[model samples]
Target: MTESSALPGLPRRLLADPEMISACASRDFARIFQLAKRRGGFHSSRIARTCELTPSRVGEVISGKRKITNMTVIERIADGLRIPGHLLGLASRDWERAEIPTQPQPNAAMRRLAELQNAHTTVPSRELDDILAIAAGSKVTPTVLRSLQVSIEDYWRRDDEHGGEALRPAVIGQLRYVTGILQDTADPNYRRSLHGIAAELARLTGWTYFDARQYSTARTYFTESLRLAREIDDRTFIADVLACLSLQATYQDRAKDAVTLARAAQDSARLDGGTPRLMAMLSIREAFGHASAHNREATHSAINEAVHHFEHVNPEDHDPTWVQYFDRTKLTVDTGTALGQLGDAAAAEPLIAEALQAEPTTNIRARAFHTFWLARTQLQCSKVELACATATEALDLATIVESPRVLTHLREFRQLLGSHRTIPAAVELVARISETAN
Candidate 1:
């Protein structure tokens, strides 16, 4: 392959950068993830929501089981990392020609796809682009983008917050419709264009199953989402999926799996100089796995790494859309809890307190974890009354999110408080949580 005789559209320096290789190897995912976490501010839970990719999928790509062929997906990942297409040595039209396999059994894939798409159907990209152009060209106050985000967030959260079974089918229908559309589009670029939607649908589907406690189906959707993300070459989305997978692994007591997935997620982040949001999430998730395994040193290191990334974020440098859940307060909360788990009650107390006091509502998820940790810390400090209060708060927050993750914390907190049976409130809270757990 002479330089002059190279692929017509390929860039001269495409193969020059070792970063792409590093990306494929997943070697630098942790650093890249840190960058993304800082840039996008994504938390582990919100990474999928904002990035429109399954967190578990991040690992699949790093493990090289998932191959990336779509230029658009690569571009999207590059875009999320704020890297130029030319820098990745991609030709202008390569993304358009990138091959992605539609399901061999189109009928089944389409039916499944259509069910997913119809649930969250939106105006075509052409229409969206036109509106965006107008907004860019003129002073448009009523931008549709903001409206779309809010609406989508609401739609995304609806079923999870309320156990409404009726809406599930409708949502699934939307997913199937979108999947069908991707499968039906004749244009080669169709898969690339559909990548974002596909990732989003897969994520929503996975979340639905996760919330419903259907772990197996949730894992399947997450895996599918990860495959599509790689076909599209979107590493950040891939990282998001890996995070989800890690969460599931942790929830299921698959600590080693969680650690392995977290490492992969970190690699994906490193490959593209990933968003700061993803970085913090990967670190925090690593902390979770380490904590679960009782690896205090590793947990502390992960927490510290997460904190370092959180301090260096610049919102203006980000992709201007998605990512944006990571922040200092959240990192502090995570760090504090991790420390608490390592038995550093003194160090953990201030971090959790500060996090809880700062933007409490925004910290609902953080508080859930922190409250549980705080309870433990209080117990360690022999503040039984404070421990009981913290335990109750944790349980209440867990009830609100219907998270088994949080429920597990509630159970642990209950057991801790149960040792001090003299307190009626503690006894009652423990009983309530025990019943809920059963």
Candidate 2:
């Protein structure tokens, strides 16, 4: 908070400058270096040495031709220049703790923390002062944890209304940051919250990949999320990850695996004392698995159980944040989708139609997904013109959504309409679909 001095290198007056603070807040490293050079005595070569970067890199940064993103370099810049940790979203540095009795010396815990961090992180930093800061348990304030939660929740909201294709970079970056901190963090108490935050972020990252239809990448993140959740013994979150895996399995047509995963999710949720909404969510996945496997009896059994659970759901019941989305609209949509997969075109059409009609207009991603399902049911029922019209509506939303999952289902519906190609509406729909591809 005070003026920057020799080791924490920038001058006090320069640090207090409004432009300096704004640039640091936005991480405009080029602007930061330019200001440092002009206001502080930091020429490019000196800046390069201070921040553990090359002179050429420093020049590029000052010229606004490149931006610094690597955590290691950012940490060095913060430490070498003694920037306030809060300005850069880092832990308080050793220099900031000058008045306190110095436990800043590298002890066994700090060394071990550094080694583990180096082994796990691709962007490993040379500065271990923050490791000492972690050893002192100075990073990851409650506010920081809460901020992480808010960020993940915001990402979820955006993914719901819009799609995850545009958000994958930010979500994955956040996951990696939390993961790295978790790997080096020494305090058990801090580790617990870190792991919980990491789990949620990993799960969110997986969901983004799932929406992008990158099954392998999504599975990797899902598995990482499950591992973190288990480490924290967060049964509610554990069940959510398993449900995600189950849904991904169903998407990949691995029906048996989906069934197994859904059952695992149900078991985990039961351990946490399952809420009706939670049960209903997992049960629908089980139904999806059964339907995908062509097991009509099992599929209907699961669907019936889902409906029963939904009927028992109390809106006031305290369900997990993830389970809050499984309201009546979701239940109806899933049931219809499962029924359609089970080859009951007549039964599926009405439920999907009702769901499509009931869904909020602003929930473009969900609307796109549901509209395609409704279109598929219409096609199966030989309502060719109606199906084409429905598909076109979904196509419009899909363009806005950019979700591979929505487009994937739309492609399947198009293929199903192949038999009716001679129909004028079908021909027109094919041309429209072609336009989207272009």
Q: lDDT for each of the candidates?
A: 0.62, 0.81
Task: Give the total clashing residue pairs for model 1.
Answer: 67
What TM-score would you give candidate 1 relative to the actual structure?
0.61
Off by over 4 Å in 1: 1-151, 156-170, 188-190, 319-322, 360-366, 435-437
lDDT tens digits by residue: candidate 1, 253-288? 888898899989899877878866668778898888
Candidate 1, residue 78: how far the Cα is off, in Å = 47
Candidate 2, 1-438: lDDT as tens digits = 332235448886777554465456556687789889888988888777767778999988777566677888898899778787766778887767873443433788777666666688555563332443344343667887787777677668767866886556556656666777777778898899999988998888898898888989999999999999898899988988999999999888899999999999999989988999999999999999999999999999999999999999997889977788888988999999999999898999999888877777778899998888888888888888998999999999998775888877777777888889999999988887876743
